[model samples]
Target: MRIWSQCVKELAQFLRDRLTVALAFILPLLTLFIFGFAIRLEAKNIPVAVQDFDNSPLSRSYIERLYATNQLQSSRWDGIGSPQAALDQGIAKAAVIIPPEFSRRIKAGETSPVQVLVDGTDVNNARVIRSSIEATTRFFVRNSQLQTNPSLIQVRSRIWFNPGRQESLYIVPGTCAVILWIYPSLLSSIAMVREKEQGTIIQVYASSLSAEELILGKGLAYLIVGLGIAAVVISISVIIFGLRFAGDPTPFLISTPIFVASATMFGLMVGTRVPNVTTAVQAVATTGFLTALLLSGFIYPLSNIPFPLSLISNIIPTRYFIPIIRDGFVRGTGWLGVWFYLLMLMLLCLLLFNIARRNLSRMQLPD
Candidate 1:
């Protein structure tokens, strides 16, 4: 009964703070909008410069094939003397230099080398441009009279997951993990710290509530709020962005509460350590947000990160939850496949909640 009363008081306090209420409701949607629209992984319509010194039908044919792929767009650099000039002036991301002997070399069954110059400024864009140019050139050679060898090996490729390569398909599910990590911890940490800063915590301490009851009450309030925000953001992803859940939603349903519990308890731990709301918010932003952003495989894969840094990612609870969300939602994998991740999340919840309970119990109460 006392715990229920404390829970109600926490909810009332949370509802009364206009700033916390606004952030609790508004921040998650705003974050989803920013991540959905602003950040993009796939590059398209890369501008390319074609410098054909041959000026022959073969060179023109090659240039036409590049445009047909729809990945590269030819840019006219009139009076730009050379392809290098176009590249130097930022007129094109890539340049194709066809030698005067291109057709003759091909007709004579000799090796013909075409120089492709790519701007290395943006590594990802440059890699895509190089691959597209190579694929297009290979396709042209296979179809043209230049291919005389009957024994030459040919390769066929197909992409499995995210076949259309839509960036949103990869990004939206990850955004859910990022959003859950930020808001739950931030809101709960600020809520607890606000009570400390305003001296309201003394009243609660004097009300004969046990430390465990106090922690559970505060955590329950934010857990409900966090879950509600998650539903809104997820609905937006499905309705607005068309995010699909391929796997059984059972694993996701089971894992989310565990993940949310860890986040809320983490915030409680932060709240107990910090002296004021400002410090708590900053702590959550720097520790929770940055750790989830960098270490959770949201922006970069954990396998790709080098040792020591990669070692740090192992402990981040968000790291475990991301795979659960991606596996259940994007890959449609069953519980057997995602059981490991769910287990990790459950263990983290237990650990964080235990630590938070202990910390809250030890906090010095005002007389």
Candidate 2:
């Protein structure tokens, strides 16, 4: 792939300048470390898939009791098929299996082991699921004393399309979106600005290449870099975070390039406006990175933002991009849930490209 060449180029550039070495490697790692320690969102509305072998009144009652806690929600099992299948498909966070003798043992003054297989990819959420199960089991045990009824109805609810509440499910996709967007754009910005500082941009101004061609060519190169970044980041996420695809990978597969192109154009826009590499890098680091990270709902909800800044979030590409990514990995609704967001990403990409094209065109001087 072109990424190999790009990597070699990047290594050469970093070797040529120590400042480039710090910018290329150190900054990105710091960003990831900051994200790791700072983010601690509370878990709620977690989906628990049920495979009740007992299918008895007591088992159904336990399911109902678990759902009542509000911390745990129902998955798509509907009392049929393997709970493991749902977990494998990313349709549930935790699976509960009640053994055949569950009710009989409880009624006979014996304890029963209700199997709970939790998705451990998200360690914190796994802990929450375990705690919620224990508490609900205790509550159900206490409540059973007063109920003489021999029958109980199942409690079934929670986003019907499917579910998985692993923090990595939500975290990886959004984090990838931000990383893919910011890094490619930052690289593009720095490259173009570095060329300007070296006076090589004058060669482009005198060449047959139009402004669109020049900008598009630069973006195309970095787009390859962005996709490479995606592969490495996603692979790392899968190995480290244990995240898996929740649905058809088609939507995510198609949209990544479009999202990266928009990001590259955005960086080119900065390079076009600023005369120096330092200003271009700062513009990307402070304005571009902060806006994409904060406004995109990567780590926080858009609704939770203040009024003035909330309005600004609507224009942020990550605002639309994050939902599509979250849907593919966390919600498993496929294209149905993400089609609108995908369309929005396309629109934003076009908008950003037009702005970059115009800005670069304005910078060209008469011969």
Candidate 3:
């Protein structure tokens, strides 16, 4: 009865604060749209300067081939003496120079060297540019009667799952998980700390309400709020991004509330330990948001992280949940693939709730 009463009171108080209510609903959707549209893993339309000193038909064909993939575009190096100047001035990411003998050598069935300069400022972009140049050169040599002897081995490539290469299929589900993790924890942390900041927690210490009831009650309210947030953001993602379930949604449906409850419990623990609401917010932002963003494999694979950081990712619940959500949209492996992760997620949630219960127990009146 006390748990129900406390839950109602928290819900009522939450609804009364218009700003908090708006933050709960509005901010998450905005984050979803911003992250969905803005982030891209592949680099495209990189500008390159082409100095074709040969100016022959073969060189012209090669230049056209370079731009055929839509990955590279011609960049102007006006008032510059050399192709290198374009890179120095940041006008282009790469420069290609064809020698005078480029056409003659190739025509005589001899290898011709073309000087290519790439900006090393961003190593990944530089790698992409190098690969593009190499691939295009290989295509030109193989298909344009430029190779005197054809290689004995012919390669045929096939792309598996997500052949259309819709990036949203890769991005939106992970974004949904991150949004769900961060916002509920932030809101619940604020609710827990607000009572302390305003000195209203004295009543709890004086009342008969057990620490379990208080934590469960407040967490229950915020769990409902988190569910509502999830529904809105997920529906918007489906409508905007055309996402549909790839596997059994049963696991995703079962795990969401457990994940949200853990977030609320994490917030409650922070509020219990911190002196004020500001510190609680900062704690959640640093511990909750950063871990989810970097360690959870939301943007990159966990194996890519260094030894110690990779170890840290193991404990991040988001690490476990991202695979589940991604499986829901892209992999469709079903429970056979994701059951272990689901179990790990549930264990982590229980751990978080226990920690919060223990912390709040120290501050409450004895039963």
- Best prediction by TM-score: 3
- Minimal lDDT window, size 10, model 1: 145-154
Candidate achieving higher lDDT, 1 or 3:
3
Local accuracy of candidate 2 as per-residue lDDT tens digits, 195-249? 7899988977887667887777777777776777777677766777776787888
Candidate 2 residue pairs that clash: none
For model 2, give the 10-residue run with minimal summed lDDT: 1-10
Candidate 1: the clashing residue pairs are 246-332, 247-332
lDDT of 3 by residue, 1-367 (tens): 8898999999999999999999999999999999999988888899999999899999999999999987899887763599888999999999999999999998887889999999999998999999999999999988797777788998998766587888899889899999999999999889998998898898998888878889999999999999999999889999999889997898888888888887888888888889887898899999999999999998987878998888888888888888888888888888999999989888988888888889988888775
Q: How does model 1 score by TM-score?
A: 0.94
Candidate that would win on lDDT = 3
Instruction: List clash counts for every candidate, in order.
Output: 2, 0, 0
Alpha-carbon lDDT, every model: 0.85, 0.78, 0.90
Those runs of model 2 whose alpha carbons end farther than 4 Å from true positions after fitting are 1-38, 43-164
lDDT of 2 at 280: 86
What TM-score does each of the candidates earn?
Answer: 0.94, 0.64, 0.96
